[model samples]
Target: MASNFAAPMKVIAAAFEESTGHRVRLAFGSSGKIFAQVSNGAPFDIFLSADQAKPHALLNAGLAEPGSAFTYAIGRLVLWSPVTGRVSDGPGALREGGYRKLALANPRLAPYGAAAVQVLGSLELVETTRSRWVQGENISQAFQFVATGNAELGFVALSQVMKEGRIARGSGWVVPSSMHRPIRQDAVLLEQGAENPAARALLAFLRSPRSAALIESHGYQLPVSEE
Candidate 1:
């Protein structure tokens, strides 16, 4: 699972375990890192990527079961700050330019980071803000950087600071989807788990209405077809 999905996946996995008696052991990290590990024969049964590209790459490389990959969630990006009004105006706050450090995941290792880069480019702040960056290896760490006041504000997954359509703490501005490509997160059955009933069952659970609602409560959108 990608680190951005950490909170929701944990809850979903626990619910699946309780209802089906199937224990799910999950490992979360940047999609890029996990993709490399999967390609290198990491012993993972499933791949829940932060983008469609990685899963598609795995399928093309014969690392994942053909036809098993599909979008599970559409992630939202947000400009956030732990301070009450730091980011209330969204990109406007960024444009105001008083903050010393801005945190974001490393674009090479996380889809959210790639989106953050896109957002910066769209806002025309790339050159001006690039020097103040505090890059995290993954989105979780980026969020942590802001939450701990290491960075005044940063780009993070909306799911990290939201629950049930509300910001859980601090302030945030949901980035407009038009600013970047849709964050279509995909999930696939790895070749290693093609014959694993538990893996298959877990995948089925992700597509269930139960999981769909649970996913939305964490501030993610379902694929249009599911919606």
Candidate 2:
């Protein structure tokens, strides 16, 4: 699972266990790192990636079951700070460069970080803010940097700070979709778990209305059902 989905996935896991009597153990990290682990024979039954690319790669590598990959959520990015009102100025804040440090996930490993870089480039602040960058191994750690004041602000997933369609604390600007490519998060059942009934059940449950509501409540856009 992607680190940004940690909180919501916990809820979904609990509900799943309660409804199906199947316990799920989740490991959250950057999608790239997780993909590497899966490729190296990690015991993960399902791969919930932060982007579609990794899941597709796993499919092409014969590491995941065919026809099992699907977009689970569309992520939203935000510039957030634990301190109240620190991010209200939005992209202008980045251009003005008042903050000493800005945290973001590693672009090489995390899709959100790549999007953050895109945003900075769009605002023409990439060079200006080069020295102030504090990169985290994943979005979760990047969020930790801002939450702990290690960085004044960070580009984070909206799911990390939102609850029930509203910001839980502090303030942030939900970056416009036009600012970057769509963050289409996808999930796949690993080939190692091809015969795991629990894994298949979990995938089915994820597409249920109950799970869709939980995912949307955490600020993610649910996939439009074809039917």
Candidate 3:
């Protein structure tokens, strides 16, 4: 699973285990890193990527089951700060430039980071904020950097800062979707899982209404599936 989905996937995994009596062990990281590991023969059954491209690459490489890949969720990006009201200024805060550092996932390895970069470029603040950027290996670490005050502000997944469809703590500005391309997160059944009924069941559960509600409760959008 993508690191950004860590919190919610925990909930989903527990529910799945309870209902099916099938224990699930999860490993989370940046989509790119996980993809690399799978390419090099990590014994993973499923790949829940933070972007569509990685899953497509796996399918192309014959690492995943053809016709088993699907868009699972659309992620939202946010500029967050632990300081109260600090992020209410929204993208304008980037332009105002009072903070010394901002954190984001490594754009080359995390889709959320790529979205953050897109946001910066769209706002024309790329050059101005370049030197102050602190890159995390994944979005989870980026969120931690801000939460721990390592960075005054950072771009993080909305799920990291939200609970029950509301901000749980701190302050954040939901980045406008218009600022970047939609983050369509995809889940694929890997070749290693072809015979794993539990893996297949988990993938089916992810598309269920129960899972959709759980995902939305954490601030992610359900994909609009086509008939």
Compared with the true structure, what per-residue lDDT tens digits does model 2 show for residues 178-218? 89888899999999889999999999999888999899899
Model with the higher TM-score, candidate 2 or 3: 3
Q: What's the number of clashes in each of the models?
A: 0, 0, 0
Cα RMSD, each candidate: 1.1, 1.4, 1.3
- Predict model 2's lDDT versus the native: 0.91
Q: After superposition, which runs of candidate 2 have C-alpha atoms over 4 Å from their true positions?
A: none
Error of 3 at 143 (Å): 1.1
- Runs with alpha carbons beyond 4 Å of true place in candidate 3: none
- Regions of candidate 1 where Cα sits further than 4 Å from its true position: none
lDDT of 3 by residue, 1-227 (tens): 79989888999999999999999999998888899999999999999999999999999999999999998889999999988888887987788889999999999888899999999999989999999999999999999999999999999999999987778898999998889999999999999999999999999998888888888888888877821
| Candidate 3: residue pairs that collide | none
Candidate achieving the largest lDDT: 1
For candidate 1, which ten residues in a row score worst on lDDT? Answer: 82-91
Error of 3 at 113 (Å): 0.9
Model 2: how far is 58 from its true place, Å?
1.1
